[model samples]
Target: MLAESPPETEQSAPPPVARPRHAARAAGLLIALAVLALVAVASIAVGAKPMSLDEVWHGLFHYSGTVNDVVVRDLRVPRTVLGVLVGLGLGLSGAVMQALTRNPLAEPGILGVNAGAAAAVVSAISFFGAATLDEFIWWAFLGAAVVSAAVYALGGSRSATPVRLALAGTAATAALVGYINAVQLMDTKALDKLRFWTVGSLASATMDTVEQVAPFLLLGVVLALTLGRPLNAMAMGDDTARALGAHLTRTRILSMTAITLLCGAATAACGPIAFVGLMVPHLARLVTGPDMRWVLAYSAVLSPVLLLGADVIGRVVTRPSELQVGIVTALIGGPVFIYLVRRKRMAQL
Candidate 1:
């Protein structure tokens, strides 16, 4: 036999853990982008007066004086852009809310951010006659801030739990909604105006609205991403996170600020669209594992896909009469949410 080498000393080799998480995230992101592209193309091609793909492509790139060019540029373009912005804001805000509360079900709507923004807008419209978009922005921001403070105050203790925050948010939402309904009952004109807004449409989006809200969205996205590392640390439990050198109070405050600005600006721009915030983060987590960094990034990409797809669906299903994006999302998200609940997967967070 060939001289056997002396027994090799055992060197510890790191275990080869599965790379499923990274691969899954990459695949999910690719899927999201593909869906977004498909929706955008469909949105341009399927409308009251349908356009050929060639026409749509030419209009988008070359700006030929075609019917598709006018429709895509003037109408669908603004709506699509607004959808992306709003989705990004909602997705990021939702992820932040879930992290802060340590609750998978935590969303802007669940935590009263949307209601607060809506209440502020209604008040501004009713009291100040703020017919313009610019006038409503500040009021919405104030409302979001006040409501967030109230939620924190009501639920926050030396140690607050997700259940407590949810309860407080529920109570606050019910009271605010009652007040809004009362106002609507008393003022038919306000009701008429609010009806369109409460349903959430991107039809009114303008370049000015986009510009006004972009800064907030950009800041919120940055803050949300920055907080991801801290959020992951915090998920290990507050005491553990503290031991790991995470500043609990600062993280919470910063997360709240980011969410408030994002949700408020989105609400101000497009009214209070729902479900994207609630659903997208959970979906992202399912795909990306529990790591907040990947979850946040995936949510940022995927949320727009859902919103734009819903918008496109809304545009097509009714032919000339389009459905509101809010309605479509609620319709689609409700069943998916129920399925998640039934599977008991929603509580994983």
Candidate 2:
């Protein structure tokens, strides 16, 4: 018995483990925010009629010098605000769309939201001669809603597949573009208006236009944020989500509504700007991982950075003459899109 007791076996313990990765992600997000702030300031200060740092400071708060004050307050400030709104809307909507469809390439522009809004605007201009921003805004909103509903109805089954949604979106986009082209061919006056708006310049932005669309954008943003957790749950497939107590159909419908409002307001404000929606979400995901919370936050900050930076570049590249923000985004986003496709990663969605 004593000999048997002496032969007690030794036991082993598990190795020490690493801390959670979320803390590191939180730190990175803080850094990203700081960088975004710096870029925003640079965007505000370095416009066509270059303002010194001191002038920017005074203009923002104190308000001195007629020219500096007007430039900063009237022109740059409104444009920058719109940029922030548009970026937030596009980024958040893109995130929701991607999550809902489980597709990385899904964006309002790519999925016919922009095309729908644009078609509506074109029809408004061609048929009704609606020249005011307010008139066009309503039409754009209606068009966006219709197209979004169509996309969902066609592509969303008991289990919504990304490929089917994409195909439906593509078909809708093609039809809308064809309609626009036909109108442009027939009506030179409408073509003139469409030519400028289609390129997406922020130059025409005014306080009135900003005010008109701000409520819609704000509502959409709030909905998108609230839906983030649900969307994350939904990404695990509809059946799994249902088992997890998530309402699949309700979530999809609400998400689509939010996208319609966000995309509609953005398109109404800045005419059919492409690629920001598509590019910003992917870029945000790369930085913040797959979490919708982080993705939306990064998008809010980064989208304005891209849109405003593009706008500033547009102002400077041609000096007295300026390129459109839409053109700039297209030039940059098109190549990036191709690269993503060539890399074979985007197709995984």
Provide the TM-score for each candidate, comma-separated. 0.88, 0.87
Question: Which lDDT tens digits does candidate 1 get at residues 91-131?
Answer: 99989888887776677776788889989998888877888
Candidate models: Cα lDDT each: 0.81, 0.81
Clashes of each: 0, 0
Error of 1 at 178 (Å): 2.9
Indicate the residue-level lDDT of 244 in model 1.
Answer: 94
Query: On a 0 to 1 TM-score scale, where does candidate 1 land against the true structure?
Result: 0.88
Pairs that collide, model 1: none
Segments in model 2 whose C-alpha atoms lie over 4 Å from true places: 1-20, 54-58, 61-65, 152-164, 345-349
For TM-score, the strongest prediction is: 1
Q: Please state the error at residue 331 of candidate 1 in Å.
A: 1.4
lDDT of 2 by residue, 1-349 (tens): 4554333343343333323466676777787668767766766787777668888888888876688987887778788888878878888888888887787667787788889998999999999998988888889989998887787678784455666877888899899989988998898988877887876878877788899999999999998888877877776767788888998889988898888889888988888888888898788778767778778777877777788889889878887778888899989988876665466446433
Root-mean-square deviation of every model: 3.9, 5.2
Residue 111 miss distance in model 2 (angstroms): 1.1
